[model samples]
Target chain A: MPMSPEAQALLKAARKHPDRPSDEARTRMRRNVMRAVSAGAGAVGATTAGTAAAQTLFAKIAGGALVVAALGGVVVGGRALFSSSESSVDPKNAPASTSTSTTVVGTSRETSEALGSTSTAANLDPTSDRVVASSALRTTATPSASSVASSPRIATAPSKPAEANITSDAASAPAVESVDVLKEEAALLASAQSALGKGQAARALELTNEHETRFPKGALSFERRAVHAMALCALGRGTEGRREAQAIVDRAPGTPLAERVSAACP
Target chain B: MPTPNALRSVNAPSAAGGVIPVAATRGSRSTTPPKTFDDLYDDHVDLVWRALRRFGVSEPGLEDAVQEVFIVAFKKLDTFEGKSALSTWLYGIAAYVARNVRRSQRRRPETPTEDAGLHLTSASDSPEDEVGAAEALRVLHALLDELDDDKREVFVLAELEGLTAPEISTSLGVNVNTIYARLRAARAAFEQAVVRRRAKDARQLQKGGLPCR
Candidate 1:
């Protein structure tokens, strides 16, 4: 069919139909695009960043704590079980360096002095490592994790020697109410995961921070850290994300969480 | 756009891979690389958005759909060989994304273009023409909504967006002859619908209403 004049006029009008997006819309679109671009753009560098961020942030945060299962799937600060040699990798000594590669659990003499206890003094209480860890912390440190003292789940933690045994009991809690507790905490974790999956890294960060604040000694601390690292990397904070993820791997080497962290960070 | 001898050249990757590659166009006049995705967005967002609007995506979801197209294009940046005009590649993405938006949106029928939105009115247009254009577009889109998806798409692309039959074929993944056939049928259907709408508008005008349905 030949194009009618009326069709021509209408088509012209239709072709002019799209309004330029409002400045607000344009700004919003740009912000989202930039975020995605930076996120995806960073994906190439993510492995390195995730490891660096995990390693750096984890050590700085963990302080001198040896990674104990009782410390909510991560070591916060504690005595060095290692030999009397001064920390081979002291963060304090190499303050000039930006690399967190040297952040060892009790590597720095400062970390050892900061923690200042023999491994025997701060032994892991399979049932209450938080109790022991907190008892041995710097005065500036926060109280034994609120997550531990409050949640009834900790009360029943068996005096099992193995960290796995502590984790296993928490996972397979027998009481009906404890399952509800676990479910509630799991839902919070899921929300953070959902945000990350939806590409809302900022929202995911908020959720992860909230998760940490609300459940400091929660069982899914490692899981939360995983998502947190991923979100940071997705936000283009590669160095930090790598450090966080690498920390999980370093502290809990040979464990499932460490394996997952290693895979994700790499 | 003609397909290059190979799917991709190491020097000139497609848009799917990353940024737009440099094209040696305006030969000897330019040394710069080809336009980036941001450049592409600045050039074509309006075209994609308008086409999407005509293709049944409501205004509320328009921005997201637009962003999705660019995001896809950005990812597929390296895949964008100079095989087709950048616009064509973008249109292909926009159409598919808008269709997906439409598919999900069809469940709860919302007509932002019709109800609250008096879209397509221009500042230069006389108040009467502005209102008239809006009513005309409403009838146009309403009529457009009635045709089957195939006819509607062809009509929207060929008439409204003015994509050539070959471009339409490439963008829509249909044969060139099929586009011709569809465009022919679509135009006929469109003419018939316009006649019906004008007659309905006359009838409504005779009833003394200020605006035509």
Candidate 2:
């Protein structure tokens, strides 16, 4: 007997009934949404904070470099020395004349003989020695001395602080956990697909049911429904399968699962 | 339903008409001290969920797509001009996200059984015909499972969503003519499947077996 138009229309309407989100489900979604938003906001804040801290660090490094360069210039300038004529000609300032002069002459002659073979001995003269001592005093006066002493300390500072901050920040950051959830959902979907491939409709349905329980809002739900519809079709329960597939499509129009549902029913 | 020409007029690029008036500049009014990410989620939660449903995104993928859509929107919110409705913009994002999900699924080698089309239209019926209509729709859904994703989408958007061809073209980034052609093919395919299913069920009933319906 030919089916009445009324029957066909009735079936369509029943299939079209919008699946309402349960209150508990809605509450969970609201929470998930809140969690996702918080995670996003935290990510943004962390990125901004990281950039600002890096800029401050770079500025400090540049300032320290400039100070080091200035100290280097002072050291180079102190090395070149030119004596005045007065120091060489002042007799009163010179060693005692005669016997004292003879003793001085003997010592000077011996010093010159020793220095003739070594330019290093010539630089060890009192004037040069005085310059070297003054240069050393100036080097010790600047922050460069402390900076050099603290180089190892500075090298370790950033890493130690960063490790601590990262630990604390990770602890404080909001957990979205979407990726993990998605992975689990994807795995279930894969298993369901595998079961369907093996021609085990019941197993497929079980996997889909599990997925539905865990991820009610998952796109996989529609796909699972489609699989159920296929199973129904195989069992000669085409009407029920068709309805389930239609519900999936109606609930999630553009999803791959909807396509699956539609195909199975067709 | 609006005629195609009328829809065209409504969607025409005009200085005053095509633009949806917004209550405030889309991103500028965020004077509420930057919302904790949680606040943004709360604000658009329903919008995202509804849009995903409208787009026919399935349950398993729905949450991820929802999260992605909002994240993308938040990151790019600064670029949103106040000219268009925020919901529309978000819907556009949801559509894109849903499409991407489908594409990724396609790349994997899956069983042929995984292939199913989406049914867009509800068979018209009075309240008195509810039960039978429901059964028929279930059959219809099963039949839809044979269609490819592309055909399924075209049918859903054009018939169920009641979006005009041009609107679908814009949403899917396809040519308008392509939408029309796809719709025609999808409808034909669906009708043929339904007729075959009905015939099979009738045969089974005549053979002393219970009709699956």
Candidate 3:
């Protein structure tokens, strides 16, 4: 069958109808892409600063070689203590002894201050500390109860008193632990950024996944997710990446991070 | 229409390849490089909108579908090997996106016609003429709705979107003969539906003592 004259006329009329998207929509989309790129860059900056601050603090506290030597001493001391009579102590009685030790250690104000600083630093810089702690803890701590119960208390005892004294001494003390975490996060972000910049999207995606698993609550978590979305986009998984980006935006609204997510998702 | 220079060029022997003449050879020189997904949207937005209008997609729905098509194209651009013209490739994407949009709308029982309103022909004409044109377009849309999806897609691509049959075939991944057959069937179905609509409208106009023209 050939086309009827009326149907042809109708099609011609339909073709004559105009339908382009508005200027505003195009502008919004461009803005979204730009925002995602910016957020990834910003996360990298914050992480780098935090990493530098943490390394400086670590150097000042341990004095490099002495800190390494002290760590070796602690490991040897731990093994000896674990083999001693303390290994036979009942599990239920351990907390009481540990608390008592902490109290004794806290009696010295200087020791308390040092411990407080270290704890604060750990919390602030959890990214590096987390990696370091996981690896260090896995290697040094014997699974035996005596080693787990007594070692941390004894090791932290001297620093606890110093930390206690400095509680009020540095009211304005920057959160060193958070900074370290930020630095580690920044390094991950930088690696992802570099990979993405070079169009190695699959590598960026792999790095993002590793970062997320290792540092689920790391400061750069949201930013890492956004980068992951970008990697997805590059890989031609736009719909999936869009959904992930939307999730990031919903979870972290109003932050610079959210803006980045929306940008990528959009 | 062949110029003397064109004939001479065709006759001239190639320095490198003895059998093939330089000018007569296909794929010898690039026209425009194939458009990327981003390039497609940036270049043919107007064409996309026109295609959407033919499918009777509402303004907002059209916007969403257009964006979806381009986004999908962006993700899948690596697969596009410049085998077909960019416009043909894009039309296929737009058709797929529009069909999805229509299917989703069907599940909700909302009237796309009511939502779309009579605004398509309402802008440039007198109120009475706008109403007539809108009413005519509505009838045309009803007729289009009667055709099967494949036929309707071919019809829209060829008649409404003004693509050549070969272009439609390439975009649709069908043989040229299939496009021709679908276009013929689509046109016949559309014509029958339009005649029925016009007859019904005439009867109502006469019953109400209104002018039928």
DockQ of each: 0.07, 0.04, 0.07
lDDT string, candidate 3, B7-104, tens digits: 32334322111111111111212344332223334566666666755664555455434544443343233244445555676677667656655554
Q: What is the TM-score of each candidate against the true structure?
A: 0.48, 0.38, 0.43
Backbone clash count for every predicted candidate, in the order shown: 37, 51, 27
User: What DockQ would you assign to candidate 2?
Assistant: 0.04
TM-score of 3: 0.43
Docking class of 3: incorrect
Sorted by lDDT, highest first, which candidate order results?
1, 3, 2
lDDT accuracy of residue A5 in candidate 2:
62
For each candidate, what is the lDDT?
A: 0.46, 0.40, 0.43
Residue B135 in candidate 2, Cα distance off native in Å: 4.6
Sort the predicted structures by TM-score, highest score first. Answer: 1, 3, 2
Writing each residue's lDDT as its tens digit, candidate 2 over B60-176 gives: 445544545654454344333433444445555566655555554454455254212212222332423555444444444456545565666666555554567876665555788
